[model samples]
Target: MKERNHTTLTEFILLGFGSGLGLKEGPFVVFLVIYMTTTLGNTTMVFLISANSPLHISMYFFLMNLSFLDLCYSSTIAPKAMMSFLAGSKSISFHGCATQLFFFGLFASTEAFILAAMAYDRYTAICNPLLYPITMSKQVCIQLLVGSYVCGGVNSMVQTVFTFTLCFCGSNEIDHFFCDIPPLLSLSCTNTDINVLVLFTLSSLIIVSTSMVILVSYACIISAILRIRSAEGRHRAFSTCTSHMMSVILFYGTLTFIYAQPSSLSAPAQSKMVSVFYTLVIPMLNPLIYSLRNKDVREALGRTISSVFLK
Candidate 1:
């Protein structure tokens, strides 16, 4: 028979909003506005990508997936976070917390892999223009996306299982807004060496693997750009990947701050702020970065808006 080391945690109290002194309506309203914007922005990107013929390529397909993930990901926490601010009760049940952690990990990791896939797409499009369509065929694109999701699913399953295995006989208050693995692990009464090692290993794999792919793809892209003789061509080529590069930077930077370290490394307040960047700010920024900065997406949105209004 298999044995478990720690008694399982039944529930966890979330320590959202840090301090609840006079934060009655303002913060709630602000988050509500932010959540609404997140939904609208991400939804618009998905709809535009699906409806526009030009955006039916591999790059836009991945962008649509990222948009979908961002929308659902933000929905998971922002509403509840706002509710916690208003209700002054930050408690989340054991099952509920686990559920949150599962989807959160699922989407966050998926985004990392999706960004890597997008980089590969860009690399093929620019570095091997003749073979772009052949290399990024429909079947290949589907597999890349499906593989990203599968990676996320497997990682989430392992991390979530190991996370919930810890005994929570003592404090239930999670020091962050959500049921993150780090903060939850910090509160466990049992030995978490295995969980910590597994988490660190899994996170390292995701971060390093995707970062390496992005770096290699960009290296090829730079080589292609340097070979082009026309200054106008170079500018146009570089502009194509600008928004995607920005999104990658924001997503990876925030993720590194949150997961790529031991809990002992960060102060509570600093951790909370970094968490807010990945959870709140990055999701909000991604759709905006793509839609506003990229002319093709902006034009697609305009056409969609006109068509809908005309009907």
Candidate 2:
């Protein structure tokens, strides 16, 4: 293996699902619809949450932040991807690729932290009901959101800086749709041992730590729910958590599969497909999951719609 110097590569060619069996206008159009729905769905959720619902409670507050993160994460990749598909130019300038990586990392990490905070919120509400209001006060929720963003921003900076530090003076073809660390590292002619190590360390920190926190919180929640004598009470309590659990499973499962494995086994096409789940499909589903099941959100949406139409 050769060591890579600090030389610069001007542009990167994205080998997006290249020559796959069923990739063409039909699939591209389908992706366009998914991208559009993701944007609109998340945007609608954010707007609805902000207005009409006085539930300035911690759960909805964190949800709003999650919606914002989803919108951002989707935007960071999907539009450029659509362009690549339509224009037959899957080329991204090096700086543009770095920019995508930065925002993608930032929003993704933020969402993970926010989800963990939400699990903790659920635990507080279920296990320590009396102290829920005090524990998840407005100030504390705001602090959590701020801290989430701060952590994400710092991590993004570190990852992006290190990722771009090595030279890509030879191959510029990235095998995935978006600029992800795994595929980007593959294109580098450098010995990316340090970069790979940093990526793995960061992945472990973000995924493992957050996941443990969420799991512990949920464990407490499940324990508290099981203590409820009535079957209906238990059912209702479990229902409230179902959406969050599903979202966590999908996001983390794909993330761990793509990142935790040896790069030798990484499949660019498969990674892109799964990336669509977390980045595009999840955003659309999250708003629906939170809003469709909750009466408060439904009322809020109704109020918002009425306010808009009547005015």
Q: What lDDT score belongs to each candidate, Candidate 1 first?
A: 0.84, 0.82
What would the per-residue lDDT of candidate 2 be over residues 1-311, giving only the tens digit for each residue? 34545354578887676743233575578778987887887888788777754867788888888888988998898888777776656788988999999999999989989999999999998888899999999899989899989998988898899888877767788877789888888767767888888888887789899999999999999988989999999998888788789878977887787765557236667778887787788887888788888777888888888888999
The TM-scores of all predictions, comma-separated, are 0.94, 0.92
The weakest ten consecutive residues by lDDT in model 1 span 1-10
- Highest TM-score: give the candidate number: 1
Backbone clash numbers for all candidates listed = 0, 0
Which runs of model 2 end up more than 4 angstroms from their true locations?
1-7, 19-24, 309-311
- In candidate 1, stretches whose alpha carbon ends up further than 4 angstroms from where it belongs are 1-9, 19-24, 263-265
Compared with the true structure, model 2 gives a TM-score of: 0.92
lDDT of 1 by residue, 1-311 (tens): 02433345456666675654234476678778878888888888898999899999998999999999999888888877777776746677788999999999999899999999999999999998999999999999999999999999999999999998777766778887788888888877777888888888899899999999999999999899989999999989988899999999988887887777666334777877777777777788888888888889989988988998999
lDDT of candidate 2 vs native? 0.82
Any residue pairs clashing in model 2, and if so which? none
